[model samples]
Target chain A: MARPASMRRSRRVGEALIERSMLGCALLSVVTTAAILAILVRQTGEFFAEVPISAFLFDTQWTPLFADKHFGIWPLLAGTFLTSAIAIAVALPFGLLAAIYLGEFATPRIRGVLKPTLELLAGVPTIVYGYFALVTLTPVLQKFMPELSGFNALAPGIVMGVMIIPMITSLGEDAISAVPGSVREGAYALGAGKLATVFRVVLPTALSGIAAAVVLAVSRAVGETMIVAIAAGQQPRLTLNPQVPVETMTAYIVQVGMGDTPTGTLEYRTIFVVGATLFAITFAANLLSQRWARRFRER
Target chain B: MQTTVDSDACLSPPYRTMEPAQMSNPGVAAKLSVQELSAWHGEKQVLVRVSLDLPEHEISAVIGPSGCGKSTLIRCLNRMHELVPGATHRGSIQLDGEDIYASGVDPVLIRRRVGMVFQKPNPFPTMSIRDNVLAGLRLTGMRPGDLDAVVESALQQAALWSEVKDRLREPGTSLSGGQQQRLCIARALAVEPEVLLLDEPCSALDPIATTRIEDLLGTLRERYTIVIVTHNMQQAARVSQQTAFLLQGELVEFTETDALFTKPKDKRTEDYVTGKFG
Candidate 1:
């Protein structure tokens, strides 16, 4: 009943070919990631050979494109953190509340309609969000605060917060739903109402997943280009004020990337250094979040 | 002489009711009285018109085959059955003469008065052992004056205090399966519930753990009116003073455990007890 020798050899060859093709697909992503890291490191190294590392880290101004060049990364760093902080402040409460409502309290019929509608916010193009911040949100805010700038960090920060709400809501809901029903039953048997059970038992159990979601969303906000560039003006200043113009690391990269600066010049190379710094921050945040999630699971 | 006869008739009813309360130990008042209770999950009926009286400060066991709706019966006791989507029930369950399912009665309060321990151990994985013990009180928003004393008393009652006292801050899931089940028991007891319901609590445990919990339940019977649903006939005989035998969602017999095991009146009960058919 065994197959012929020729047929057996052909099947083995076909299986080996399939295995090799799958291996190739798997290695493709690794190769692409390594390549990106290599280019960033190489260019960043070349940029640093010309500009002093201390000046890049400590100097106050970041006007490399202007006549007076100061390449301190502090201004960009400050602007990035300020906007990200504001975004997290807005997103944390709204996203978490929405997730809790969807996961714990909402009826299945309501969740069916509401969850898709919420996620549609993520599908809207980033350029549309940027324009909305610049034209609609900024003018409305200026009506209240007459001194508000035409292009300011507040509008973009708020818009970015709205843009990332779906990410947090989706992830948080999954985490909350993953908690076993028995735990909730135990809580209910103890006379805990819906809200009490959510806050006391469900929230704490889902904390690790929620933390990972927030970190990933923050990473997305840090790398976001259009909203910040269109609304947060290219005025790199080391200030925490949101009413005035600011330039984030991402926004500066967009500015220099589109400009007519010579590719070999120091001004042009500044983007790679800033990009590396941003990458490092986000990479660390992602690593920390993953570790936290793993530790919670192990426990 | 006629008036004295009427008064005697009125007084004799109490003594008459006490006669059938227990064959061996009479006069123990009923803590929970379920009368003509029927339940359904979605469209499928689970429990038929069932009537039983659980004695106060004693252990009662419900024994049935799988899918015979014994779990549903106990869940109906504290109104936990209605929590499931599309689950419905008729008739009334009275806890100390108060109908738990009456209009304007909150199921939440009923559950607090009648706490439950499930078959599988489910300690809040996020909370510490100390916190798990106090979860019933803290989650219900009552901050007791001395949290440590409550934890100590609850753990002691569950017979888990000596093993877990040194590591109160450890997560509740860090313990072994039996200890975690005991923690769940402690969690249920910490709220000082009047009635404690257990649904096949030792189905997932080893014999040694089962023996420990049975011994613990023997001690718990002095304070809490307890009802346990068990599939094992020996477990029901060993741990319960009163035993109710159920088949196909119908109550066949309820009497003293010794009588139910040794001399079941109903033929089906005899078959089940004698292992002729489950």
Candidate 2:
């Protein structure tokens, strides 16, 4: 027999309420993202109105807070790229090797314990990493290279690399594990050793996913703030020398965002412009990674 | 396990202490011999003391109902069974006259001599058609003298060269299921293995594809010793010269395909062949 009308009506009301609440939760993220984008765009527009686009884009130095006031974003861009490059150089090989070991060589018991322990690195606060880079890593590096600065790009870049290892490892391991057993069996049947099978079949098959992971890690590196702000000094110099100090876009924003600059000034507006540039770079990287991941699935 | 002692007796220099009933054919020499082979996954035994002689340069078929250890038997032939976690085997298998499972014998080298095709088509998805055919040599780091010639010959042997010749640069996964299976066959052939083990290779194919593969296998039998595990009785009869029927992990009947189908020696074999029960 059908349920009573009153009970059915009450059940329908409950279902509608749950559906509406779920939709509201879904909409919340979209609304927050749109608001962030709007703020970045509007403030960036105001900043650019005062500072010429050419000066912001092609200038060689960034000194918005100084009396000399050169607003070139190139130094910040260079510093950001240099640190991220260092991070990728450190993290890529280590992360990929760890992923291969965890996915291919390690037994289930070992992987179960190791993967979460490695991921625990991701759980540590960023500010703690910042202090570690400044206090622990910088002094260690200084012992080897006597000329190394107390606050330089190398220390923070290395720390950032260590911080993002779990991101690459977790995602890369998932990609490697997703390769079918039949493909691996085919390789083994052809007399391929574990190394050959891993390198020839598994790695190539998981290349797209691994690449996406690396790109995501690069994006994370590019957007990282605390470690760079603490260890990479506020010297906005357009140089690739890791031994010297450099300032990143995020680091510059952190410098300004600490309530030092007056409200509604050109220095304050620089924060939005730099933030916009960072958003654009990271957004492009994320888009490229997503596209690559989708292509891998389609194939 | 009486067959274990008989196989041990045959292992000596005499090599002729075989029971007349155990042989598939009197004249043909065995290429690979399974002597009282048994296998287990963890603690659950999948194959019970089974013995068979796969004649050189001929097709042998293992037929059984689901989970009757037909696939396990063929996997044992190539040492592929031991790859599974907690999977173990007892007894011995010999290739030519060498014990494949002897201490210090590398399973990797054994595998190169005995290649396998699986139930599903598993061409490496990232590789080009030509690369898939050459994957065996390339993956094993065995440099071929003439890459183009090797690719052509292997694909030709698998009967896939003509269809895929123009699209060698295309990804292997781009081909149809049958073409992909043939591609995998070409890959297995590229290594120039002495024996080929196929586990239900045509189970996932259509009748036309199945017919194509059967015809291809007929040609392949002249060059390589083949063991195929099939669930379809007609397929076993159509493609194999020798047929072995398995039930509940035991080898019930093994003889000439014609004799086994027409006049099964065991009652269980007779019942299975007559479609009485699995």
Candidate 3:
């Protein structure tokens, strides 16, 4: 069959367009990842070269406000861990129980309604959650404890915990569901009741996936910037106390970015330093989850 | 040995005693007395008022064309069908005398008594040959110490010991098709059940492997009550002592294997037996 002249031209155009779009998208992804990594390494490397690695790692006091430079990493690390500890403490039980209730106990109709409702939290902007935390949760906690600051690790961590509920629940549900049906049947056939099967057979089998889920969530808490920046008062005290004000790495980066610090100055380099730290935590988490997921699949 | 005119009433065992029968011929006085057995899936009935006894201690094969409730009937023996969601069965599937469906009777206990080898040889893929032989015992929560002695013996009983003894720690799935089936049988036998139900055991293997399983079945009948369901008529003739012809969810005929093949009373069974039609 002979092709019509106009149809052949259109077909050639369509082929070319598709080929360009595919190659263009592939190039775009590679360039974006490589560019981000290169920028982070170059800027952060300069900051490290200027500051002694020992002083930056061990110094407890962070005096960016003073004339003399005193860069302490502990205060920032302490603040990050404190908020993460609080966030995880709040999120773990609530998220796990919610997942169990939703995945094992809920009717399909209930899950249909609840799953989308939970997923809606993920779509909500972190800035909006920060505002909600600063305005609402801070006031509520302050009323109970008069000594508690309005903007502190406590409120932001709690809000971040609430923000993470959807992620933890969804991931937990998927991990729980991925357990083979035959194992469940085998348990049932052995006279194990529904609760027994879940606790004993299903839970042990899904341990690796659950661990990966928790690691991913921990990294999420560590990397969260906006809520803490707005709600957690910018006093990077190296304390375990949740009631006290603390400046997380993410919050510190945002604080420096909002200022009139010159482009090539040490203060500008601080943002990239925090970014590199955040990237490390997230990268380690990704690697851990990948290993855990593969191990679980091999089982 | 004696032949009676009304053979439908009772087929006398050649040995007539359990003592003489354990090895030579386990007196096929085996009788099944299923009463008012009604099975359901949620509200939908699958086996409606199913009431029939299986011949005991003999290779009683259940044969039917596709979807004739053959698998359902076999699963009911080991209380396997009840594991499905919304599945329920009413009435009793009695053994020599005891009712298998009573409330006080544990379904697990019943399944332990009536061991089943599934349509598929589902040897635990992760478990080794030694572990596979002790699968039922493991699930039954039996002590590990006691199982060690029985595991080897059970494997030997299933005719897999010679082939697998050197590599008992090797995964069950690492075995050949015939070996896997035997491993499954060993797993079932480890529990020492009274009746062993083979649900189309040979359908998955090649002809040579199928023949080996059949030959194993013939030898196994001396120790346990064997009931197998096979699509291959040659397989049924080769292994089973009795044959029950089923069609469209109903039992058409149940008789001696030789008689079923030679002179089937029912037209349907005769047709099925004579290679005319299924």
Candidate 4:
């Protein structure tokens, strides 16, 4: 029933080689992350030397291109926060409700037809979404409020929120469905109705995964460039009002990258400094999300 | 190839009268009665014309091989089988002479009266051990005024109070598998159901854990009518007052556990109990 001794020994050797190669392939992604960090840190060190960390962090105005330049980080940081907060506020409730509907309420026939159709929203290009926000959503909003700007954060934020709904909903649905079927049966057997079982048992159990999904969505919103660049306008100002124009860090990067600023210049190097800040914010969020997801897995 | 079973052949001496413990209280009636039950998963049939009577405050064990509808029969009693997509059934299951499947009767109400434990322990992972015991009451909208007492009593009844009392705040998943199953049992007991259905509760447990659960079941039968489905024939012989042997979705024998084990009437029942074949 067993393989011959020499043949088995050769098979074991072949398997060990395959395992080592597969492990090496897995390490490639880690190496890529390290390379990105190395490049960003080296450039960021050079920029901070000339800009002085105090002025970049404390100054209120960010008029780098004007005759008198002030390199304050708060204005861009505020812009990123305002747009991402708006996007998350709009997306989280709708995404969670859609996930619940898809996971618990829908019949198999309806879910089969609806889930894929909803996920298709994720397949649309971000540039197309940018175009839609700038041309279509802005005009539609201006109809109700005539004072609305041609380029504003609200339009782009709302469109970006819509773009993020599929990601949160799909991830949340996977989390909910992964709660063992026996858990649902236990609740049902305890005389809990569909709503009670879903809210009390299913939702609470999948909370960590849902929270992780929301964090990923927030990171996506923060890094979103095309939509903010095209629709949120080019003015970097310290404002929390979504109705006004503001430039995010990503939008600033896009602007400087498009303008073809000479390499090694302070203006060109500013992008990497801003990029380092963005990386820190997203990296912290990702760490928190991963921790929560890991705790969920311990169950 | 003998398919048909005789009702009289399966009837033992104990079937004519209640057991010695119930003889002093002869006024008690059958707690659950299933008549001509047939169930289907979409177009494929699973249970066919199965009928049995479970006496009040007693343990009844349903024993059969895999795919013999042992789980289906118990799931049908609490209407849990209906939760599966495309699962349908035609049966008259009466709880205290009231048909549970009648148009006016709600399954939620039926389930409240008849709580169930699954084959595997499924304590709410997000909840604490203390909260897990009170899950039924919280989920069912009948929040107890004496929350501490209710949790203590339920855990006590499930024989897990002493072990979990110190770590009541810990997550339910932190417990061992046997402890988790008892936590699930405590969760069911908190609802104060008239009957408890256990579907292969010990199948996932080790022998020591199985013995503990079996002992708990013996005590639980004093207050609540209990029905268990187990594949282990020895388990049925050890724990049940009445044993029902199901074969190919039909009730082949329903008699006292001792009588059925010692003198099985039907050829199929004898073959199965003797371990000659499934």
> Which structure among the candidates has the greatest lDDT?
2
Clashes of each: 0, 0, 2, 0
lDDT for residue B23 in candidate 2, whole number 0-100:
42
Query: What's each prediction's TM-score?
Result: 0.92, 0.94, 0.81, 0.93
User: Candidate 2 DockQ category?
Assistant: medium
lDDT for every model? Answer: 0.88, 0.90, 0.77, 0.88
Where in model 4 is the C-alpha error above 4 Å? Answer: A1-24, B1-6, B9-28
Off by over 4 Å in 3: A1-20, A60-66, A97-114, A120-155, A190-196, A295-299, B1-32, B42-44, B123-140, B161-181, B206-212, B273-278
Best by TM-score: 2
For residue A136, model 4's alpha carbon misses the true position, in angstroms, by 1.2
Tens-digit lDDT string for candidate 4 (A91-162): 999999999999999887988998899899989998999999999999999999887889888999998999
lDDT tens digits, residue span B1-278, model 1: 00112112222321232222112233568899887788899999888777777889989999989999999999999888988999999878889999998999998999999999999999999999999999999999888999999999999999999999999999999999999999999999999999999999999999999999999999999999999999999999999988887776776667788888997766778889999987
Q: TM-score-based ranking, best first?
A: 2, 4, 1, 3
In model 3, which residue pairs have backbone atoms overlapping below 3 Å?
A: B30-B56, B32-B53
Output the better candidate (2/3) by lDDT.
2
**Which pairs of residues clash in candidate 1, taking residues 3 or more apart in a chain or in different chains?**
none
DockQ for every model comes to 0.63, 0.74, 0.20, 0.79
Task: Give one digit per residue, the lDDT tens place, for model 1 in A1-299.
Answer: 48899999999999999999999999999899788789889999999999999999889999899899999999999889888888888898999899999999899999999999999999999999999999999999999999889988899999999999998999889888988899899998888888899898988988898898899899988888899999988899999999999999999999999989888899888989999999899989989889877865664
**What CA RMSD would you report for each candidate?**
5.5, 4.3, 6.2, 4.7
Which pairs of residues have clashing backbones in candidate 4? none
iRMSD in angstroms, per model: 1.1, 0.8, 3.6, 0.6
